[model samples]
Target chain A: MSGAGVRFDGEAPAAGEEPQSTATLAAVAEAAGVSASTVSKVLNGRSDVSPATRARVQDLLREHGYRRRGGGARQSPLLDLVFHELGSAWAMEVIRGVENVAREERLGVVLSESAGRLTPGQTWVEDVLARRPAGVILVLSDLSADQRAQFTGRGIPFVVLDPAGDLAEDVPSIGATNWQGGLAATRHLVGLGHRRIAVVGGPPTMMCSRARIDGYRAALGVAGLPVDPGLIREGDFHHEAGYAAGRELLALSDRPTAVFTGNDLQALGLYEAARELGLRIPEDLSVVGFDDLPVARWIGPPLTTVRQPLTEMAEAAARLVLDLGRGNAPVTRRVELATSLVTRSSTAPPPGS
Target chain B: MSGAGVRFDGEAPAAGEEPQSTATLAAVAEAAGVSASTVSKVLNGRSDVSPATRARVQDLLREHGYRRRGGGARQSPLLDLVFHELGSAWAMEVIRGVENVAREERLGVVLSESAGRLTPGQTWVEDVLARRPAGVILVLSDLSADQRAQFTGRGIPFVVLDPAGDLAEDVPSIGATNWQGGLAATRHLVGLGHRRIAVVGGPPTMMCSRARIDGYRAALGVAGLPVDPGLIREGDFHHEAGYAAGRELLALSDRPTAVFTGNDLQALGLYEAARELGLRIPEDLSVVGFDDLPVARWIGPPLTTVRQPLTEMAEAAARLVLDLGRGNAPVTRRVELATSLVTRSSTAPPPGS
Candidate 1:
């Protein structure tokens, strides 16, 4: 859906017939022993409905496979973009991507942060329901099963953008090729005659991080180099974590000649660590990072990083959600855009080589 | 209204009596020769209303000083935050600040970018009117006179967060002490025995930039030093501008040993220029920057900069707009937060000293 910097790798599945709902609102209301207005209030997320009545109505709506009538008139000209955390240049790129789509669609973006939670709070869902946005694009965040059911019955479509961890296969999502990016980064170092390469990974809970680390190990295996368990370090994808890991790695009697970082921020931290220890980049200890953020080029010696195409991914997510909102079932539920390596000043051959 | 960094310099002008509206919807409809429903449609921003009738109604509304009865029930649980452009970590800070207030108040934030237009387009105004957010925050952007009047008639309160250029005296705004920041930065360099210091300024159209340059001139005058026009350069608060200015300044036969930049991004650009020319920070040049962005600390030599309290300013703007929306008059319409100089490794005494 993005205009640039994205390659689709998966073939679309054949389109299937749209599912027709076999139940009406009156029937559901009768079965739940509530007025039709009560069902409407629940659908609109009004807080006046009692919790027990709301729960009973929701179950009946799900059981009946009730879907609200879809049309532009019923939907507000807005798209909700929720983030796990809004802290870095990373989020800015995603926001820009969504804005690109929003501007074209003449829709406003309602932004929310989950405040470190993978799923947004109940209040956020209620607000989204009340606003009746056309669709929602979630960045590294998800909706609970009940939340998903609520939106499903109300005919609100949502697509997850670059989910940090693994998600249900049925969820519509967009992500980058982390495994390929990791393979490319490690291969470049190996081709440059780096045998003792240390790999610093992001949080273990994140599927993308695990995929990248797996790719790193796969590259080592194909290159006829033994993967050194001692050389592997884990970080939470922050500068301080990188610094701590860098110090631990460099303190060893036989430190690696190059370090592959989880992300650009970690690479920056490693830079600070190397500076404190009187080591030069490329000339002494080469480094490669993921997520070629803006600061990657501005930093001293410039970082060679994997381009994640974050903005493009976000744009794709927005487009997909809107399409779903328009009752267009996508051929593919999950799409991962291609990631490429951008080599700059951060990587070089081992000093002795 | 931020809990920190800001200082109240102006005493409150005594609160004036609230203006009372003598006209009713029926009277406006009678004057326009339209039904009461048509007047209601105009007030609700319904597109069905003819442009001629809508304009007439708006005129009557403003003429009547029609303040919609103030109440939470009439407003959506949302705050609109509009930006000139959503780029860079600078915007992320502002978004975070606004998010802080929005979360505390249990309101969603609707974000829009003017797409580099100093004033948002009419479409944005229409969308905002339709959304009926409790309040709006404009960052480095302004509303047109007509746009302001429309919001005034609708009783939608808005505040400018750090107006880039001069705004009307009546416009409520929050900004940092750019002049004092510039004075402090230049004074730091002057106190370090650097006489031939240069300053790189942001866009001349921006009032904050002008104030900082004025402060630079004042600092030079106070220290009994001559201001060199040849050493001064203008940039649009970007890295490339800083790099270009740095190159020109460094190539001069009698180059200055110290430079102060308008912002941190420019400072980073200057660092790149110095690096390319085989100049070392503090050893060959001393530099200072404005806006203590997160990257300042992560750079090679941590940058010395003026902390603009951007997040705090944004929070203040949000609070002020919400207060105005709740029919609470602000003591003062303008607020300036304190900017303090953070001395880091980027600045030192002149090379020869």
Candidate 2:
């Protein structure tokens, strides 16, 4: 037991598998007949190398399945962007927009959801802090006032996505103009010459749902129309609730000629309910939605709805996080991205107009 | 400016908020009119402090929003669990299962997503790793083999929820046995006196699709029934694809007496397509599905399906990550859980039985 070293490298801690015994960089350099640093440059594809030499090195590495490590730390002067999970196609559109800017900046991204819904005794903040991540993009899913304060107080440099705060003003955030989204949907219906326009919205407590209702009323006011109480329906953000609300609205003595739903999923339900009642979209009743989720274009008659600038929000969130990570002070300003009105087959002038 | 010494025993940074500046354990202790260590013990929920003392400390901290800085060399014990975006409900279910164990262990969690789909040149791993989380949970949608190997090589403790790995033997993974889920679904129909059962499945590249096909074959073998290649159909994991596949399968001269689909979403498509063809479920034909997603029980003529045990898988994944984090040299085992058949009105004895 003289002082000979016992190596604790890639050998087993009694693990039964032998598959992990791959060639290391040191071993490869020895066999390839080149210095370690020289081998590194060739493997990373960083600088000039003769074509024959590069091929020879790569072939040798391939023979032993040698993987070069530690290259991911190159530190591309780019932002690390992230997003909370939203939807399939809806998320993709936002990514497409963000990629254009990120490519220009040579930035990397890690799009991810914040921890699940804010509940008592559960928050991902502590763990997120441990990661020493450059900056954070937190998509707040209805956290309580206290939770918001705690998150903001930590001062990790973050931008809140799709959220509204009852917390004190120091927190940073970015979001689409949801109130305006509601207004646009209602105005589109009014432009179609419809008077009895009903609204199917999401949870009453959600900020987006409330803002949408405000916008809907504003558009109705602009058209010189009074809001009808019976035409309004509160819904959860899902297809089933949208269907139920549609059935209720369609059955009223004063049925609406048009209906505006809070999101595409709810709008899909509205479509189902209309079908059951033997109503054709736009022909018998006009339907418009908010957030214009991806499937809105592919399903049934393309839906006429307001589009949230998801990609812009993502890019903005990334930029804001970068600013925070750079030791700059928190940006107290809240960013508001514009939404567009997409006209499709789901809307038209009311029948007999 | 000669010899103007600066001593930073408890020196503050440029927090620049209140006149007192930085918000930290000491600052909160000063504001609360208590000792700093006392404040720390109270905030961390130590039991030695009197209840009255703890309450007083908590009340003062809450009154003036104070947060202690993390990342102070102790390192974060919190784990980051990432998933792809879809509906909040699905992610919530998995979280429920994972949190049940994580919280009990006093380990905090960080959440993230890979956005919708993988985009070219987006280093999602960078964004996630930047947090320097203790470990990671990749709730992968679909991953290429190279991607899986990259993490394995880094020695980062990770577990895949649903992997697309030919290297399953070498990776630490936990998922429902899809083929067994499929066989359970198919056998349910045969138990109800069904014959000529047809299948509607998602992209063949998906691991679950392959597992389901294996199950379908195994069930038929046990029943002593001849395998009919003509009865099989391919589909994407979407409602529309299921609808189209259902219609096409029904059009065959020797139409199936029952149907089996890869997922609840696809089964929903089959439901609509069957309605369009004027077919009554469990009357003209019986239908069964896999994945037993939330919507499976809510729709009309509620669906019968094979449940994938998502909850169990999430819990197991969390446990595995924790074990690895503890520096235990554990073997990478593919832990497979069981699936069950959920009976509902959508299935019955095939017609003319």
Among all candidates shown, the one with the greatest TM-score = 1
Can you give the lDDT of residue A115 in candidate 2? 37
Tell me the tens digit of each residue's lDDT in model 1 across A206-288: 88888899889999999999999999999888888889999999888999999999999999999999999999999999999
Candidate 1 accuracy as TM-score = 0.89
lDDT per residue (tens digit) for residues A247-323 in model 2: 99999887999999988778888887887799888899999988876557544567898998877787786666666
Worst 10 residues of 2 chain B by lDDT: B1-10
- DockQ for candidate 2, please give it: 0.02
Residue A36, candidate 2: how far off, in angstroms?
49
Model 2 per-residue lDDT at A108: 33
- lDDT string for model 1 (B1-353, tens) is 11121111111111221334324766788888888778776765556777788889888776665666532344667889999988889999999999999888777799999988889987788788877788999998998776787787677889998888779878899999999999999999999999999999999988899889888999999999999999899989888999999999999999999999999999999999999999999889999999999999989899999999999999999888888877677899899999999999999889879
Which CAPRI tier for candidate 1?
acceptable
Lowest summed-lDDT stretch of 10 residues in model 2 chain A?
A3-12
Indicate the residue-level lDDT of A237 in model 1: 84
